[model samples]
Target: MTTALKLVIFDVDGTLVDSQGDIVAAMAHAFDRAGHPAPAREATLGIVGLSLDAAFPRLAPELPAEMHGAMVEWYKEAYVELRSRAGAAASSPLYPYALETLTALHAQPETLLGVATGKSRRGLDKLFEAHDLGRFFVTSQVADHHPSKPHPAMLRAALAETGVEAHDAVMIGDTTYDRDMALAAGVPFIGVSWGYHDADDLTGAAAILRDFRELPEVLTTIREAAA
Candidate 1:
């Protein structure tokens, strides 16, 4: 009998790449452009996994709700401006062993990789292209196509696209948003420690990883437990 496909869906920004500095900077720029105080760094980073519309309001609740859309637009422009500067990508480095971990997982015949990120399609594309990492994903669900994290739409679409059952898939990320989404979608979640949010913030995840190198073993453990 053919083995069931194992789908490992990943969160991009804080999980696969360390884009917090850029994200916070862009958010600060947006708030500044709106003539409001920039959110604290912790507050800005706290919303890493959420879509801009959902995140902006939380970051600047004092501002008028109608201004949230403009904030998002300003944030996009600021982020694009930041990315255009030389060394911006270098400053936002991927965590240790990120590519190695993905490469190891991709090597498995039964494993199919997917990305479910709050990043816009254009942003995700640039990231994949910059790192030459586009080949790793068999499917990708971005903010352009779905609601924010903690909503099961992206994961559901990924499962449908790959024909993988929820039980045969795992969501790997670094935030409570990812955990909640997986919980809602009936998929197991594995959290990573070295991201914007604290490891404790991911209490709802099935397992929280301290290192990128731990991912393969964690995935194996999850698969075995489900068996």
Candidate 2:
């Protein structure tokens, strides 16, 4: 019998690249341009996994919807401009062993890798290009294509694209948004502590990983347990 596919979906920003500095900077720039008080770094990081539409409003609830929309656009523009500058990519370093883990997983015959992230397709493309990492993912569900996380749309799309059942997939991320989304999708969820979200926030994950090297083993364990 053919072995069933095992799909591993990841959250990109905090999970793979340490892009929090650029993210925080862009958010602050947006708020300043919009003539609003910049949100604290903690508040900004707390919403990292959400799409701009869902995220901006949470950061500035008192603002009119129009202002939130403007802030979103400003944030995007600032982020893109920031990325275009020299040395900007260095601000977001890939976590240690992140590429190694992806390479190892991609080399496995039955393993398929995917990304479910709040990043726009353009942003994700830049990240992939910067690290030469696009080849590792078979599917990419980005903010431009799906509802904000804590919603299951991105995960569902990844599973559909891979022809992998929910039970056979694992979602690896660094936030409660990732955990809640996986739970809602009925996929196994693994939490990585080095991401933006606190370890305590990942209480619902099947396994909480402290190191990127622990990923393959965690995936194996989750698959076996599900089987």
- Report the Cα lDDT for candidate 1: 0.90
lDDT of 1 by residue, 1-227 (tens): 99999999999888888987788889989998899999899999889999999998888788897799999999999888888784445746777899998999899999999999999999888888778789999999999989998899999999999999999999999888999999999999999888878988788687898888998888888889889
Cα misplacement distance, residue 202 of candidate 2 (Å): 0.8
Clashing pairs in 1: none
lDDT score at residue 214, model 2, on the 0-100 scale: 92
Span of ten consecutive residues with least summed lDDT in model 1: 84-93
- For each candidate, what is the lDDT? 0.90, 0.90
lDDT score of model 2? Answer: 0.90
Which residue window of length 10 is worst by lDDT in model 2? Answer: 83-92
- Predicted structure 2, TM vs. truth: 0.97
Provide the TM-score for each candidate, comma-separated.
0.97, 0.97
